[model samples]
Target: MGRRRTGEYFSLDDAIIQGQIVRVRCGACRRAANFLPEDLAAVYGGSRFALEPLFPCSKCGTTDFVRVTTYSPEIADFGRITLRRPGPKKLVQTWENETFTERSRSNYVPDGDFRF
Candidate 1:
């Protein structure tokens, strides 16, 4: 869907910022949720805009679920933005990378042979 002019989304003509309460629905399970303008703005940088409502999987639905929304200023196009709480995978990858680097460091020797 196309985004409307930034002014259309805001009520106060002089207010630089404005937002609306919106209902979001899960594309997979169709579970719906309400999000306040402030929360939406916080996720999208608090500007007048329209965004695609992305929802979480039923199994992963929670207050911490990720949201992919967008925002556009008066003369610009809405850009995609993501709101997410890091998941287990992110933690695991971080730990794994750290461990790998540590192991490599431990195995290195000051005079280890080097070749072009």
Candidate 2:
């Protein structure tokens, strides 16, 4: 028998505007903290179908991780949710060599008179 894939849960009605965080067991670690929703999207965003590994536990010396869904306000459809996990964590970690670093993280700072 195979282990069940974890399901993501979120309450939209009267729920917090910020999406909730979900924790799932790691097949290798057998622990519930194997991977986070934030991390999942980072590692597996481009695949046609999202696929994550399962381990017996969290510390099982394996790279497989559990999967769960997250409620994103940016989603277009609610019935059929689609997620595009971003790439590795280090891909955009430092702006040292990025050519567009300034433009990417820049924001307009108005003068002192623009109080709202």
lDDT of 1 by residue, 25-66 (tens): 455555555455455454554453434443345665643443
Clashes of 2: 16
What is the C-alpha local distance difference test score of candidate 2? 0.38
Q: RMSD in angstroms, all models?
A: 13.4, 14.1
- Displacement of residue 99 (Cα, Å) in model 2 is 36
Regions of model 1 farther than 4 Å from truth: 1-19, 54-93, 96-116
lDDT of each: 0.41, 0.38
For candidate 1, give the lDDT of residue 56. 49
lDDT score of residue 23 within candidate 1: 44
| Model 1 TM | 0.32
- Candidate 1 lDDT at 93 equals 18
lDDT score, candidate 1? 0.41
lDDT at 79 for candidate 1? 42
What tens-digit string does per-residue lDDT give for candidate 2 at 8-98?
3333221223443333445444555423344444444422122334223345655545553333343544444333334554423222445
Poorest 10 consecutive residues by lDDT, candidate 1: 11-20
Q: Say which candidate scores most in lDDT.
A: 1
